[model samples]
Target: MARTRIIEIDPLTRVEGHGKVTIHLDDHNNVDEARLHIVEFRGFERFILGRLYWEVPVIVQRLCGICPVSHHLAASKAMDSIVGVDCLTPTAEKMRRLMHYGQIMQSNVLHFFHLSSPDLLFGFESEVEKRNIFGIIEAYPELAVKGIKMRKFGQEVIRATAGKKIHGTSAIPGGVNKNLSLAERDHLLQDIEQMIEWAQEAVAIAEGYCVDHLSLVQQFATFNSSHMSLVREDGAMDLYHGVLRAIDASGNVIFDQVDYRDFNDYLMEEVRSWSYMKFPFIKRRGNLDGWYRVGPLSRMNTAGFIDTPLADDAHQAFRAFAGGRPNQMSLAYHWARMIEVLHCVEKIRQLLHDPDLQGSDLLLRGERREEGIGVLEAPRGTLFHHYRVDNNDQVTFCNLIVATTNNNEAMNRAITQVAKAHLSSQKTIPEGMLNKIEVAVRAYDPCLSCATHALGRMPLDVALYDAAGNLLEHRVKDGR
Candidate 1:
């Protein structure tokens, strides 16, 4: 009789929040299918009902601690529309931009150095015990220190602009509540040059890995799909603000410069039976084929160029490496992410020198509207916030498409590609083989709690089964 089995990996490590993956093997032990299942669900949308519209920007920060600022700003932007403010003052806009760039820079640094560095620096199949941030600290102390300082710099920017690190009240309905003072600016400037140098080195590390493991990067979890991001009108990468744009794998524009407020017209979310996370796709292409990728890789694919010189140069080399086509290699996300880190630091340096940041005009006001939509590129990808406020200023409806949720279909595909390539027909499963699966998922840096709109704790269950559906092995992991 032919052998067949089903493998389950619960509570995928290294990514945010709770989730699991299942891989099915056919009669010949060839992989039949793979799925990344999101098990927990929370009623965050419903949780917003009846809350004052003004409270949304603050409350939404509860979504995910990892990228709280993304939610804060996205909700604030939507509330801006609710108040009918189309454009923010120079000071307000610049402050928010600074906060955003800091958020992205620090988050990327944490992911690249503390989270994924162990895998990249020490091979994905290396010993699990030593394949962690602590391991990096032990072996590469200087690199570890740099990562910590880089992240601290980003957090400090957030503190200056947002008023505090975790969840801040700086951003209000129409604009920011605070601006950077001279002292704050001077403090940030002290580390600006060093941060830039460290960011550039980080990019080199990622690029070196890709170049050294060209074959592995080319084959492992790599596939061509549509890419999407927010780009400046002239097609430069603008992480804080811009119109939505998506391109096919060949670099053909799928949709260009569409206002994110009308995103419902161009995109639709499909609810799958097994996963709580919704699969979002472009409406014109339909659900099956319209699923596109977002985040650093997609940003690199869609942006015409990086506006900053150092980042632009790095971007140019990255593009040339892909022969001027969309880089579909999944592992290349590390390289692209580092490039964004460089861009963020450069923008921070520029913003710190701008005198407008010290301006007193921090807020704006206008006629109120009942409904509003706001979208921005978060650290992971594009984040959308929509709300309907009652006449009493209470939120009547709410919907959010978190960045990680936007990459839902893409992460599943990546996991499947890795599973098939690494686990198919294997007589015995090794921890290293499983780590490869996680490396693929981690490439996208999914935030499951943010995606599923859930909070609180949940247990994890890992199970293995025979072809006939008999459970062969099972393990449980208690929730924290």
Candidate 2:
């Protein structure tokens, strides 16, 4: 009889938060199951109850250091509903969009140059010690410098529009607490051309990588799944505001311009025994077949066109690379991300040039309502924040469906695909092989810290079971 075994990569590196990979092998050494498990839990949804509704935007921003601006905006948008405001003031909306675009630019640049570029630039099989941002700096110092400068520009834009770089309490229920000054606008304008140039260069770099490694790009953790994002009524991409849209694997739009307040009408979250992260899927399709993807790749596939000129051109080129179909190759996320970064830059320029950006009309007063729902396209993907307020404007219930949670099932399926293709009967696994598996998870660029919101460090454990379900070997790593 063939022997059964399991392989696990504890404490997945180069990604945010605590996670691990587990692959179960059958008696014939065939892959039985693979899962990407999130092992931490933070009770943000439960604990936030009883707080004032106005406090939510500030509190939810604490969910993630990397993309707090996303939470801030989403929660603020929801709170806007609680205050009975259907629309924010023109200036308030413009400032918020500027800040949101800044978050996207910073996040996409960080992911591409700092996290994923190391693998693409250095090769997945390179020496572990040298396959990081530091390695990239050592080899291509100019590129590293450009990335740093672009990220700094994004942060500066955030600082100028919001009060601070991280967790800025500028966005409030009725509107923003601040407005852009001509000086601040001028400061950002000075860097707009530079940021745009760098974004274009980044796109070219990613496209070259996709072409040079066409086979690996196509094969790496590839799967057919539905994509979801926020889009304008005319099908243009809108990160800060729009209706939710979902498209099938064949690129057919299943739903478009659906109000996020009724998310439950189409989307549902499922709990799994193995992880704290919830799996989200389409309600009508059921869990097994309803799983869909969000984030850079999904946004690119679902968006009809980007409003910015340069980004729209890049989008067309990227679609051509996939032969005008929805891109299923997981590695294409990097390409999509670069296009997003370019869009952010161009959009930032347009916003900065608007005369309304300098207007003093930042806040709108309104009476309190009992329920509110907010949704926005975060740097990673679509983020939803729903809250119900009591008569006193205190929060009664809160629910958050973050971007990473939306992609949970897709990440698992991607890992399984990578494991089965690379780990077949290999008596011993190399660090490179393990890195490939991690690469699949990284393609989604998951923010586990935001996904689970756990406080204490969580250790990672892996175990092998025999055909009879008896544990044979185990490994553990303490998280720092």
Candidate 3:
């Protein structure tokens, strides 16, 4: 008889914030099950009740240091809709899209190279002694340097748009808080040209590694799941804006225009007894049931056309994965991210060079009611922010549906697969497996802090439970 083995990872780090994962194994050294759990969300949704409408942008943006802009936009878009300020003008729309692209470009680079690359680049079975950022830098200096450049480029875009590298004061309820000058636009253009050159090299670096290490994609790409993203009617990806659409691996459109308010349609959220975060699923069609994958992988699958050259080439390469159509693969997230980054750089270059970008077409505007929804293609996946206003138009409610939340199903399953495959036989799994599971979560670049504080916060202890009613784990965290 095989004895039961349990290996758990707590407090996933090295990206945005904290998370946890646990896996179970059988005596035969096979993974029996896997669970991805997140502890310590202070119920931000409950906390955001009763605040001014205009404050929604500022308050929601505080959800996470790394992804404040997403929150800011989600809330702003929702609020704009509520107040009927639909005419945000083309220039404002272009600028916002430009900034949104930057978020995707930078965050994807960080996840693949800094967080997930360690295990793939250095064999997962290799000694843990030399599998960190410093080690990667020492051994693969070019890749490491590319990672740095990509990250810096992202931050620079954020700084130029929102006035802060991490969080920005602009992107308010109705309109942006600031405008740009011709010189500033010129500078942004120049920077984008340089970044595009660098991105070309970065792409080569990834392709080289990926080609030489086909096993990385082959192994990690196991398992197929449904994909989802926001897109225009013509099936082009709409990063900063659009309606939600989900597509299956067989090139079938599973769902479309899922009303932001009716997200409950074709989607369901199930609470795991072991974690505070809720797992989401596609309202299964027949036997194709259960939660689905989101973020970069999903976005690429859902998108039918590529607008940028590099992204288009990558997309074609991806289609070659199966029957000249994109098949489900976890590592496709890396591919999708690079494609998006390419699109972002090229788009930004065009927008910056445009004559309208240099003018002060942008103007600050306030709103009567602040309650709103901000939605954006966060690097990880579809991110949504919803808000409500009180009598005085103060914030009465804030709810966030973040990117990681979108990939909870896939992240949990992938961790379980790895644990089953690699750690089932061991009496005790290495701390590295725990970290690896966490790395899987970060591969989505989830902004946990922002998610927990999305609705609002109150102090609470998170508890995990099993079928027998045993307490598996528990942790406490504060809400901001």
lDDT of 3 by residue, 133-239 (tens): 77789889987997888788877777777788777766754566565567667666666776887777666655565567667666762577777878766777778
Q: Score candidate 3 by TM-score against the native.
A: 0.87
lDDT by residue for model 2 (308-348), tens: 99999999998999899999999999999999999999999
Stretches > 4 Å off in candidate 2 = 1-3, 456-480
Candidate No. with top lDDT: 1
For every candidate in turn, the CA RMSD to the true structure comes to 1.6, 1.8, 4.6
Candidates, ranked, lDDT: 1, 2, 3
Q: Distance from true position, residue 95, model 2, in Å? A: 0.6
The all-Cα superposition gives candidate 1 an RMSD in Å to the true structure of: 1.6
Every model's TM-score:
0.97, 0.96, 0.87
Cand. 1 Cα-lDDT: 0.90
lDDT of each: 0.90, 0.88, 0.66
Q: How much is 57 displaced in model 1, in angstroms?
A: 0.4
TM-score of 2: 0.96
Best by TM-score: 1
